[model samples]
Each structure stands twice: as structure tokens, then as C-alpha cells.
Target: MLIKKIKRRIYNLFHPIQGELWCLHRVLNEKSVFDENKDLEISPDYLETKIKHYKANNFDFISIDDVYSKRLSEFRYCWQKKFINITFDDGFEDIYNNAYPILKKYNIPFTIYLSTDFVDRKPLIWWLVLERIVLTKENVVLSSGVIYTCPDIISKRSVFKQLCDLIYNEPDNPADTFRRLFSNYVSYFEEKTANTLTWEQILEMCDSGFCTIGSHTVTHPVLTRQQENEVRREIEESKRIIEKKLQQEVLHFSYPYSFWNEQVQDIVLESGYKTAAMGYGGSCRYNKDNVYKLPRVYLVEEST
Candidate 1:
């Protein structure tokens, strides 16, 4: 642990940034057997520890709005106080059930990027579907007519990644495409989406005043994989739906699956978002970073 801390400090010394936008998905009481889902879930206890550690280190917990406002101000590259903005993607119910109380206790301001369709009862959450498939069966047949065996953890992990890539590149509706492909093994996809938040719950979070809701595309498709028109519709429609429902303008966005390109960024900006966040990157350097394609640190249990 000491060495890890030292190594982080050395890395930061060379790669300095103004602040970190911490990206997370669900805050669960316990992790699941789905290995991919484990990367997306962190315990409530772990969330609290992270909050405490950042506070102890004197990091300011700011909102997504604040992150945007900083861009307009005079940004000094040297001797700056570090800030942290916590963000949750996909609007999971566990965030309300497990994470909100802890965040409220610390009085931390956070953002939630909603896919909108999650609440509207659309989207298969393909990775979880893949997890269910691999864990349930000893051997699986791929779309390529290739038979993959995963009787053990090692093979399961490998096959999971392989399937995930295939789904990620699915140009058409990924949920529909994959659901049709794995129909026999994935009847529980609809039931599994119960884990996501409802519209009322989302509004309740907004009522807390600490939560800033952002658009994460309507169906949460990988924008880069879709046609330009489809990408535009996804970006614009989600923001439109969110703003209409919340009676407040949505100012930020998070790319679904962290997959985006220059064209997608243009659509996000034209759709009226002040900033757009990507899933993986170290931190934000105020002066140098592009607001449209801002990078974020994906925080899991083992993340520092």
C-alpha cells in the first residue's frame, strides 16, 4: 500500500491536473458473481472510505456545474488546489439505496448521467446479459458459429471479453441484436433492469439539491458505432427528454461505454451540453483539456 501511494505520487508529479471527475456505475451492498459487473460495482463501505480519504487529503467535492464554470475562469496551471467531482452513470437503483445516504452524510455534491431508456424500460445492459450466459453454461456458441468453453474462471474471463467486444461493435441496436443472438440464455434481461432507477427515484435525487442530472444518450448506444444521424438523435433526444422531465436544462453528458469520436463530440456540443465526459482518463487539466471530450477516472473498489 505504501509503495502504491508512492508510485501514485510520482505519477502525479509528472502528470498534474486540476481535478478528477470520478466515474462510477452502481454502489452495491455486495458484489455479484458476474466478473464484468464486479468492475462496475463497489460496496457502500468502499464509497464512504473514498469520500473520507479525499476529504482528509483536502480535495474539494464539487458539482459538474462547477467543473464547467471553472473553464471560463482564469486557470492557473501551478499551485492549484485539487478538486473531485463524483459522477454515477446509468442511473442504478443501488445508488439511491446504498450510495445516496453515504453521500448525504458527507454533504458531497455529485452528478448522475442517465441513459433515459433505462427508466423508460429499454436497453438490455448487454454486459450483464453476457455475464448471465457465461456463468450459467459450461460451453457457449458464438455468433461466428464458434464454440467457446468456459468451465473455469480463466476461460470465463477471456470469453466474456470476447463477447463484450463483439457486442460493442454491433452497429445496429446492440440490445436487440444481442438479445436475438442469445435469446435462449437471456430471458432474465428484462428482470435484471429492475436494478436501474425509476423516474420518480431520479426526481427524488434531484430534489436533494446535491444531485446534478446529465444526459447519457437515450438508449446508451456506442455513438461511434452508429451512423451520424443516429448519433445525433441519441444525443439530442436524451437531453430533450431529460430537460422536459426535470424542468431544468441538462448541462453535461457521459459517453455510453466510453466510446466516442470527434463527430460524436460535435453532436453533444450542438445538443446544448456544457461538457461531455469520457469513461477513462486520468484527470482534467483546466487550461489544456477540451470541455466536449473531458476525461474521467473510473472508480471501482480497488481504485485509488
Candidate 2:
């Protein structure tokens, strides 16, 4: 903790502004890892405890609306006091099923960034595919014309990182690389295996007035891999779909994979969003510049 504080102080020296801090996903139920016996769990009780700590520490719990509100009256209270905003990503069903109740109990507002593809029941995320194939299968053939065979257990992590580096760190068309990776592994999983929030659940949350919806993109493509036209379509099409369904304008976005460059930022602005969240870690202050590329802290179970 002391090291982290020192790091934050060092960062502040260079960056000056404390960007937004957020918790990505707060699951209410116990979820299974590859090994069912080693389940991942996050209970309401645990979250409540964390919230108590946040409040005691004087951190502001903010939502998407709070970030982009033209009227700063409510925010002024936090801004003057130095509170942290809370946000969730990937529009997980648990956000509706579990997290919402806790937020309401505390009257805390939050923003949920949705990936339209998953909301529409697209296949699993690419990383999940890598996990399944690498852990469950002995050999895998990808549509990208690459073949992968699992290494010894001792070397699995390094091997997986190597594969990711080859695909994601390439100078070639990043979109094509991701597409190839997806086509290769997505075929292995059934639709039911993919976790996603239903449209009804989203509407329910909207009506509850405890949460607001924003875009993560239609297909959750890495923006840096795509051309300007493709990037524009991803942003504009996602906002259009969410707006039509919710009967409310969608003005915020979270980039898929948290990958963005200046070109992608231009596309996001052109898409008419008032603000966008990045996976990069930081805090948000009212007077900070670049509202479009707002940084958010990711809360993982390990960290908690």
C-alpha cells in the first residue's frame, strides 16, 4: 500500500491531474474458473464493506451522468471534497442482478458500458477462447493459419503471452489479426457458454434509475487495429443501437480492449459521444482536459 501511494505521488508529479477511478465488474455470485472447485466469488457483503471504506476515506462515487453533467451542482460536493467515481464495464448481467441493488441501497449512481455484440449474443471474448483451447485442448488450429499446441504446464503462461504478443503486437492490420484469432477459436464454444446480459435486463435497469448505459462498441474490436471508417462505424452504430433500444441518447463509450490512438479519439468525437472511458488507470477531475479519453481504474478480484 505504501509503494502504491508513492507511485501515485510520483505519477501526479508528471501527470498532474488525478483521473477517474472505477471498479470494472463487481460480481455478486460465485463464478467458476476452469476448475469448478476453485470458484470465484464476490458477495454483496464484500462490496458493502468496500463501499464503507470508500466513504470513510472521502472518495466520491460517481457515475457516467456525473462525469458529463452540464449542471455541476451535485458534483461540486464531491469535487470540493475529492471523491472517486465508480464505473463498471462489459455490461455483465450480474451488474443488473447483483450490483444494482447495492448501489440503490447506497443511492450511488454508476455507468455501465455495453458491448453491443455481446448484448446481441455474440460469441465469447477472444481471451476466453484462448483459455479454453489452451487449457482444455491439446492442439488448436486457428483460422489465421496458425497452429498452437499446449506447452508443458510450467510453460503455459509464457506460451500464451507469446501468442498474444504475436497477434496483438503485430504491425499488420490489427483488425485482421483479431478476426483471424476469433474465427479460429470462437467456433469451439457454444452460444450458451458465452455470458451476456439480456436486453430485457438492460431495460429494467434503465427504468430502475440506478444506472445509465453507454457503448463499448458493436463487436468489441480493438480500435487501433481498425481503419478510420471501421472505427467510425463501430462507434456510431453502437450508439445508434443503444439509443433506439433505451429511448435515450447514448453519449458515452468505452473502447474495446482499451486500445485507442489519436485517430480513434477523433472518430469517437465525430460519433457524437460526450465522454469515453479508457481501461487505463486514474481518477477524473472536473477541470481536466480530454473528456473523450477519460481514464478509469479497473477493479479486479485479486486487487480487492
Candidate 3:
């Protein structure tokens, strides 16, 4: 905890502009509820209060599209300006019903990155799989050589972060380790709670003139895990689906989970995307930057 505080302080000192604050799962009316058996209960009302605070303070809330467009240029034109871009990951229906109106009212431009598979109701996401075990099982053991029990579930966020860190920092076959862990533990959520965006819903949002849709790959795989051929297929296929559905060229891609390596970066450029967003926390700079591997800030409820 002390290390994290120090890191944040250091980041604030060097990158003081607050260039972009990317947000995920911003639901407006729903309230957070704890469930012994479920991984998460979202609170839309709680999110709204944060949004209100940001607005009241006059923070510049930017969308992913804005980052690729105006904000990118702004960083070049004036590097010292305080700017913050808001981006939503995974196409959630609540983003349309709950977050959109608020953004519209505030006139905040944003980007929504979609995992094409979930749009079609594909099975569980890998991270959610870990979440299932953490949330539902009494005592779970991971193939990654980690053990977590239900009592530990009270610290769900911290547990998840630790699991992710283990996978990321593993010296040998991290990809395989993560895949084994996910495959061994994930189960589907209750049908009613399944959240995904439908084709018609996506079209409506595109037509609403409020959002810019970007590719999050078809299956939401960790790019660093897949073979080069597989990674290329994921990026290319997702662009094709998004363009065909929305009739707009899908130029931007957000790395699934914002995790990637050199090979992944090569695949993104080779697959023909203009810009690819990573989940890394940083501000954008002009001229001396790589367009394909752009960094983004992750916004939490507390940060707002």
C-alpha cells in the first residue's frame, strides 16, 4: 500500500496534466450490492456521483475517439493543458442506458471498445472465470500455484489484481498458466445478470452521434498468449465485424485487458489498425510516440 501511494505520487509529479482518465463499467442507476456467491454487484448511482464530482471540478473528460483525434493534436499543440479522456471497455448495455445520457448532458466525448464475441453472447471472459472461483467457491486452488479461499473473497479486487500480477510476471509460459487457470474455474453467471450489447443497440449508439466504437478483438484473448497467426486473425476479424455492422472503418483497437508485448504490437500494426490503446497508465505526447501502442489511464470509483 505504501509502495502504491509512492508510485501515484511520483506519477502525479511527472505527468501532472492528467491527460486522460479512462473509465470502465460506468452504470448510473444501479447500486452496489454484496453477494456471497457472485463476483460483483454494480452500483450505477455511485458512479453518477463520481461523474458529478469530475464535472463540478471542470476536469476535461475525453473519449478514446477524442484521444485519437483532437486530444492527440492538443497534446502536440499545447502539452501543458489539463485533459482527461473517458473510455469504456467491453460493450455493456448499461453504458447505453445509464452512462450515455449523463455523458450527453455533460457533452463529454468518449470511446467504447467492444469485444465482438460478447456482443454475440459467447461464453465467459477469462477474467470473469477467475472472478467466479473467487466469488463462488469456498476454497479455490489455482494451477498458477496460488490458493484463495472464500474468506479471501472479501478482498475480491485485491485478489484479482494479485492473480493478474502473477500471470503477468510469470517467467515461464504465463499464457499457458492463465489459460489453464481460467479453463479450470469459470462458470456462467445467472442468465438474467449476463450483460452484453446487441447489434441493434450498438447501431443505435453509433447513430446517436455520441460514441466512437473501437475493436477489442473478437474473443477478448490476451494477445501475448496467442500465436502470431491467431493474434492477426483476432484483430483483422474484429475490424471486419465492426465495420460491416456499423458501416464505419474501425481504426482503433484496445488490447484485451490492455495486455500486450512486442509481438502483439507487431500483430496490431500488421493487421492495419491506426492506433491501439493499452491499459497502461500514462499521458500522451506528440511526435515522440508510437501510435499503435498508446497508453491509457484506468479510472476507478475512488479516482473520480
> Which candidate wins on lDDT?
1
What is the per-residue lDDT of model 2 for residues 137-213, given as tens digits with 9 covering 90 to 100?
56656675666766565455555666667767866554457556657555555535446788998888788787788
Number of the top-ranking candidate, with TM-score as the measure = 1
**Per-residue lDDT for 17 in model 2?**
41
lDDT of each: 0.82, 0.68, 0.67
TM-score of candidate 1 versus the correct structure, residues matched by position: 0.87
Q: Compared with the true structure, what per-residue lDDT tens digits does model 1 show for residues 1-304? A: 9999999887666556788899999998667565567889899999899999989987889888987896324464446677889999998888899998998899999999999988847557777777877877798876556788999988888888887767656676667678766766656666564478888888898898889999898888778888899998999998889999999999999998888789888888888889999888878874667888788998867644
Instruction: Please tell me which model should have the higher TM-score, number 1 or number 2.
Output: 1
- As for lDDT, the candidate ahead, 2 or 3, is 2
Higher-TM-score candidate of 2 and 3: 2
lDDT of 2 at 194: 44
lDDT of 1: 0.82
- Provide the lDDT at 259 for model 3: 77
lDDT of 3 by residue, 111-209 (tens): 888889878584454454555556666666775556765565457656666776776676534445666665544343332344678888888877777
* Residue 174, candidate 3: C-alpha displacement in angstroms: 8.9
Backbone collision count in every prediction?
0, 9, 9
Give the range where candidate 3 is weakest over 10 consecutive residues by summed lDDT.
Answer: 32-41
